[model samples]
Target: MPSAASSEAPSEASTAPWDVHRLPRADGKTFLVTGGNAGIGYFVAEQLAGTGATVVLGSRDADKADAAATSIRSRVPDARVRHIRLDLADLASLKASAEALRSDRLDAVVHNAGVKFDQPDRRETGDGHEAMFGINHLGHFALTHWLAPLLAAAPEGRVVTTGSFAATSERLDLDDLESTRDYRPDRTYGRSKLAQMLFGFELDRRLRTGGSTVRSVVTHPGGALDSLTPPRPPLHAPTTGERLRGLPAGILVQGKEAAAWPAVRAVLDPSVTGGQLWAPRIFGLRGPPGSGPSAVIWRTRRSRPACGRRAAT
Candidate 1:
C-alpha cells in the first residue's frame, strides 16, 4: 500500500504549486506509458521511474521496448521498469496485451503512442480503420475498456490521454470519419488527434456519471522538437550541431523531455481532475504544465458521441 503522503491529493491552496522536477513519491504505484520506446513517451516513463513507481513501457516493437527499458534502468539504477507488447494498430490483440500486464492494479495509463505520415499517402490499420485514427484513438479506447477492471481496483486510478496541439484547429468529419473521401496527410492526422481529445473528455463524463473511481485526463505536449531534446544514448543522441541549431527555436518550442511534463503532471498531480486539459504554459507552445483551453470542436455534444460511436465501430 502506498503511504498516505503518496496517495492523497495535496491541497491546492495550502501547498505550493506543483513542480515538475520534484514529483510526489509513488512507491507502490504502477504506471503504463504507451509509445514509451521513444520521444515524449520515453521521457514520461523515465520521469515516472524517478518517483519509485513501477513504470511499464508499452510498444509494438519488442526490441525497441527492451532498449528503452535498458536506457531508463541505466539512468535510474534501481528503476522498476519493464516492457509490454502493445500494437495499437491491431485491435484484436489489445485484449491479450492488457491481460499480459503483470500488475494487478494500475494507477495510471498514459496514452501517448500515435502515428503520423509525412507523405500524402493515407494508410489504414490492420483493422481497416484509418491508420492515424485507429492507432491514436481507437487503440487507446479499446485498451482502456480492457484495463478498466484493473484500474478500478486501484485506490485512485487515472487515464491520461496525450493529445496534439494540431487538434486545436481541426474538427472531425463525421460524414467521412475514416478519410476515405478526402484525405490530406496533415488534416487527417489532425482530425484523428481531435477524435482522441474528444474521447478523453467523454470518457471522463461517462465515468463520473457511472460513479466510477477511475479518472480520465487530457494533455498535449506543446511543440516538442527532437533537435531540442537531450541525448538518451542508443535511443536518442542528438549531435551538438543539432542542439545549437535548435537553440533559436527554443524560445517558441521545446525539447521532447519538456513536452513530457504535461502528461507526467496529469498522471501524478493529485490536484488534476478528470476532463481538464493540460498543456505547456507559454502560448501552448513551451513551459511548465498548466490548464489550457480545449478546442470548441471537442466541447460540442454532437462531436463527442460521434467520436465514441465511430471508435466503437
Candidate 2:
C-alpha cells in the first residue's frame, strides 16, 4: 500500500479516475502475473512491463511463456521480463515453482491463471479436485501461502486476484465445492470464481488480524471479447470479420486489453486498499477501472473457513 502522503503528492497524483495510459513508474519492483502468456493476462503483463518493472509471466507452457516474453520485449524494446513454468492444476508443483522465483521480495502477484470448461462433463485436477475450483481458488490459495515470506519482505506487497462478473449471480455450494453432485459448466465456473473472490477478502481479514502488511485485493473483468482485442501475433490475431462483428459489442463490453485495466490499477495504484473490489467503470461492464461492489452478501467470514478447510484437505 502506498503511504497517504506519498499518494497525495502532486507528482504521485491520485487514481480517482485512473488513466491506464499514464501509470506511475515502478522501476525497482518485481511483479508476477500468472497465466500471463495470453488473453487478459498477457495484456496485464505488457502494460506493467511498460512501467520499467521486471515482469515475470507465470504459465504452464514454456513455449507460450517464452513467446509472450519475446512479444513484450518487441513492443517495449527495453522491457525486462521473463517466464516461469507454473501449473496451477498440479498442487504438488506449486512449492517448487514458488522456490524457483529469483526475486527475494515480490512487490505483487496477479492471480490471473484459470481454467473454464464449456462441456457438461466434470473434470478434475491432478490432485483429484474439481478443475475450476482447484486451479482458480485452491491453487492460488496454496501459492499465496508459499509466497507469504517473500511478499512480507516487500515494503507493501499486494495480492491481486482476478475474479469474474459471473460470480455476482452465483452462490458457492460449500458441501459440493468440487461440483460432484450437480455439475453445470457455467454455474460451476462461476462458483469457482466466487470462491476465489471470497478467499481474497478472507485472506485480507486474516492478514490484518495477523498484523501483516501484505494486502489482498480482488478484481473482475466484466465482459471481454477476443474479437474486440487487438492482434498480438501467435498469441491472438482476430480476423477482420471478427473485429467487425465485435464492433457492436464494444458499446456494452470491451476488449481483453481493456479488461486488464482493473488488475493493473490494483497493482500500481497507490490509493487502492486491501479488502476492496475493483472492476470496469461502466455499469461494472466496460470503461476504465474504479471501485466496485463489496461481496458482503456472500458472508465470506462464515464461508471462508469452510473453503480453507476444503483446500487444506
Summarize candidate 1's per-residue lDDT along 1-313 as a digit string, tens digits: 1011121122233323888889998999999999999999999999999999999999989999999999999998799999889999999999998888876899999999998998988889888998998999999999999999999999889999988868756666666788887889898898888888888888999999999989998888889999999899999998999989989999999999999998999988887888877877776788888773463344222233544664421
Lowest summed lDDT window (length 10), candidate 2? 1-10
lDDT tens digits, residue span 207-231, model 2: 9999999999999876899999989
The lDDT for every candidate, in the order shown, is 0.85, 0.85
TM-score of 2: 0.90
Residue 265 lDDT in candidate 1: 91
